[model samples]
Target: MNDLDKVESILFSQEKRFRLVDIPGAGRGLISTSLIQPGDIILRDKPVILGPGVAEDGTYCSGCGDISGSNLNLMENCSCGLRFCSVSCKQSWHTEEECRIVSSIPEPKPNQNYWLITLRGLVSEDPRIGFLQELTVQEGAGRSKEEDEVVKLLSSFGFKEKSILTVYRQLTANTFRRGRGRGLCAGVAMVNHSCSPNSRVWWDESGSLVLSARVKITPGDEITLTYCSPLLGQPSRRNKLLQSKGFICRCPRCQDGTELGTYMSSIRCTKCKPGLICPVGLDEDKLGWICSSCGFKPNPEKVSGLLKKVEDELYGLEKEKDPGRKLLLIQQYIEKNKKLFSSDHFLQLRAGDLMVGLMNKLAPSTSCIQTKEYYTRQTLKVLETLDPGLSRFKGFQLFKLYQILFEKIVHSAQGSLKAEEQFQLVQDMQTSLLESKFLLSGDRFAPPEIVENANLLVRALNQEQVEQIQDKINQKYKIVKSVYQCI
Candidate 1:
């Protein structure tokens, strides 16, 4: 059988809701075999090989999996010269082939830090494991000098020439960071990257990788994953992918800098109201950025200087302890760099998010509350364009809006409101609470604290509902939230 047949057989060997399918130029990608609704768990697979992250932190016990400190320092090296947390850990990691491999290698040297995971992979290798041959590694992503050193080291052990490179190729294209090091999840590795994806992957309690549908996916639709964060606008994301992965994304989001009318990375044009400053499309353009409305192009130095000022101020604000001071600093940042940032750009969205958090902690004033509502609404509007439906980001945004709307209601009653305005505020709170609950009720990506807010919103809604079922609704929330360990 050919390569496709081998991959097909591997994919079908287990119970699966998806299949490997060919994409022109992009090689192969996973396509849903059945219609998948939003929040459906599509696949769960444990990593075939688990090892240390690329940048390994303080040492971990190979045998017991205990991290560095205390008794770990007291423990002696194994016969193979590998440190272990205890005798059992040493015994556990010292399998026959691993011991042979370890015993043959020279001592660790400075600047060979890159070989840590490679060493673990060699240690974990079983003769039964298969090298996935179909995935190609580009030249710059080709074998490293350290890798050649590893190959030379392993060659003395009678391993075949090019054996290490064959395995390394399978690893480079497939692995993702579990913590600091690469996790080779075979099922997850098959799903190719897209900036706007229908599905997402997360780790469940057991550490098995779980892929869930973020949007309703029709049968035969490709199951794509964002290899990098979609929270960033197109240019930052593209540059990151190119720097790390050696691929220029042609995903529709990358092709269009306007980013579905969100203007996610666009600077606001000083010349026009609600106008975007974007990269003028040319491979060798002198005036890098142009206003979308007036064609007012700013020189590269002007844009770069403004961005650096904002960056320095944002960094300084991170160290500010006083909420009032931070808020002042953030506003100053906005006033200082208004020309370089649009409200929709990732940097401003991030600032808005930080400001909202600060507002929550501050004494609730009319100005603070109003600012919270504005920023929360701005965040949700950006979410609609970027993440769209049933996402953790959207869920969190709705929760914030729900809180802000309820705050407005409390403040309205405290200061005395007209009956009509009071009635409308109550109606708006109920609507916001229900929207937040609907979006967040099934979100597995939400942390325990954020997930509990969904219950609190529902409980608040119960008070507004008829008194007859209020007890019943409260009891029901208690039961459901217990499953999430939040009650």
Candidate 2:
């Protein structure tokens, strides 16, 4: 059978909701065969061949590919000289037969780390590895120096040149990191990419990759996942895709210069108070920007320099490694650059997210609470346009907003507020809690602890228990009422 036919046969056996179909310009992609609702579990597939992802230092276990116990000097007893966490792992993952195969070959040199996964594919009798031949194999220009060494090593072991190249490229394109290791899932590998995807893939508690709907998808609609982070702006997203995935995204979001009205990459224009500067066209590398309200066009080099400087400063802050200091640095950063970019620019949005976690770590202040609330709302507004409808990002943000609101209400002086105003705050917090709970309920990426916390918070703040909850929080803080009166 042809590649498409073979892929179809494999996917059909696993999932009935979607079918493999040839897409123009996109090669092969999965399409929904029936209506799929937001948050529906679409596909769950275990990796066909699991192994350590590309690591040059050989720090991971050969059996389970975990790096945790590598530092404990665990590889000494292994027959094949590969790292294994325990005797069970050595016996189970690197069996005598596999050991014989590994021992026969010369030890690969430094920087030839990609050889490990390719060798695993070649020697294993797994039927799923054979299915990988039907997948696309990228080569030529982007092949790394290490991969060239891999090709020579496989040739010396007498594997065919064609088979070696196919598996090498397949592993490069399709492998998904599951915790400490990486694996290739045949069915999951076929799902294509989009900046604004209708679906997302997450590794479950059992280590299986689960694909779920992010929005309502009708029959015949193509299913996609963002190979890169959804939080990135257009230029960064496209550049990442081109460098890593070997294609430029022409998705709807990438095509629109305004990024579907979120203005994620736009800057505030200095020449016009009410105007924002946006790209004139959809070129991913274009540096020119045009003002929306005025006819002014900024120098491309000037804009690039300013953006680079801001990015460098943020990068420096990220390396701080101390949460308290990092929080302070980001506050200073936002204060410095808040007027340069639009409120919803990706940099601001990302910094806002970082601040959320940092604020939770340190003591809460009235100013911190208000800042957190503003950033949360701004981030939610952008996600509404980019991801929308039961996405994990939006759900997580909603949960955080609920937490911040709960803190605000708890720290407020109960006796000072009018009855109706107090009721409104409670109503808003409850709505956020309910929405977050619904959105994150079945999400594989949502931590069990987070879900449980949401449920517990809901029970704690139930309308009948509000007064008791307030009393408990007030007691826990043990601060004077006047300190909280500012909230």
Candidate 3:
């Protein structure tokens, strides 16, 4: 049997949520074998070979690379002085023959994870070596240059150049920045990238790669993951993908300048109402931008200059020392950019992010409770559009939203408010708390401070609030049961 076929068999044999299939327009991709729901961790895969990244140099779990203080033990180092979180992790890293060889090399240099992964893929007795051979590497323009340098490194490990190159391509394309460096997850890596992806990936508490459905996936749907940060605007996402992964994105979002009606790439037209701007189907190139209403085509050079100037101003505001002026400047910037980048635009979302930072600094003060809530709500909306369903970003936003509602109580004397206002506040608080809990449940990558603060907030809620939320949750369960029966 071919090496890749052998590896696929092992993967298929163990997989439960999804299976490998050749998609029509795409090549080999992960297809949902059964229904997958939002927030459900459909798959969890361990890394094939993991270590510190090119820039990272620290004692992380040799097993999971968790550096966030998970009670890691310094019992023993790999032969090369790498620390482990536990005995199990240490044992796991000290692999049969492959990792022993890795440890024997005393104190591997930075960026050696690539070599380590290639070596393990070649010589490891496991079938993952065969699977690693199957991943496609971008090999057109710059491939010729890297080929020679990589081959030299391969030769040092006493392996055939062909085998090494095959694994190298797969590793470069598929490896995630995990385990302190580079982590190769066999099943998770099988999912390809899409700008508007249906799946989102995260790290579980134990550091396993968890893939969750961001949207409903019925039988036989192709599962996809985003390679670049989806939070960035279209131009930025496209630029990053082209530079890093060596591919021009033709995703639906990329082809349309409006970016699914978000107007993220639109320009500010001073002549139009609200001075709105958009790209024109101008001159035959169709690449030129113009006002949506006024049809004002801008010089591309001037557009770039304007964007740079605004970004530079934002940077200055970010570094501003005075908190109150920083917030005022942030609000002023948002007011200006709302015309440039619509409220839903990623740049505006970034403005929301800055306001969240501002809100946090003034969270204890009663003077701006309403303002804090407004920015928190606005930021939550933006995150919903960009990074939807079971994201650390969403979790933090929800947690912040919860804090804003709870702060009304803290700010008030004896937690007093009008009767209707109290009910509305309670309902909003319940919704935010429930969502934040669901989003962050089992999320290991969530900041410890956020997690702890969220916990404290939930605990601070009185018995009456807890009871109201629980009753509503029970009612929801009953409704779901009834709907299921009817279906």
Please write out the lDDT profile of model 3 over residues 1-487, one tens digit for every residue: 7644655677655557776766665566887888876555678876666654533544455554555345545445565655666678667655666555555554544344335556655665666645643433445544545556666765665778777777676666677776365677877877877877788777777767788776667888888888876667645565566555555556666666676666766666767666556543322322456676766777866776777677668778888998898888888988887757766666666776787677777646665777677767766665565564445567777777877777776676465678788878867875677656656666665646555654665687877866566556435323233222211
Itemize residue pairs with steric clashes in candidate 2. none
Tell me the deviation in Å of residue 310 in model 1. 4.5
Assess candidate 3 and give its lDDT. 0.64
Scored by CA lDDT, what does every candidate get? Answer: 0.64, 0.73, 0.64
How accurate locally is residue 393 in candidate 3, as Cα lDDT from 0 to 100? Answer: 66
Question: Could you tell me every candidate's TM-score relative to the true structure?
Answer: 0.69, 0.78, 0.74
Write one digit per residue (lDDT tens) for candidate 2, span 1-487.
8877776786557547987888999877888999886666788887677777675354677655765543657453565667677776566556566677677776653332467678877877776666543333245564467667787777787888778777887777778765567778888888888888998777776767888777778999999987777778856676567665667778888877688888898888889897888865555456467888896899877877878788778878877998878988998888877788887899988888888878887677778888889999999888878885556677788788888888888877555568887898777786666566555654455645566765676576656555444444334323234433101
Give candidate 3's TM-score: 0.74
Q: When superposed on Cα atoms, how far off is each prediction in RMSD?
A: 7.0, 8.3, 5.5
35-138: candidate 1 lDDT, tens digit per residue: 78666778886766654444455665553333455666677576766666566545544576766666667666332234444555555654213534334445
In candidate 3, how many Å is residue 338 off? 5.3
Best by TM-score: 2
Better of 1 and 2 by TM-score: 2
- Counted clashes in each candidate structure: 4, 0, 3
lDDT for 373 in candidate 3 is: 77
Worst 10 residues of 3 by lDDT: 478-487
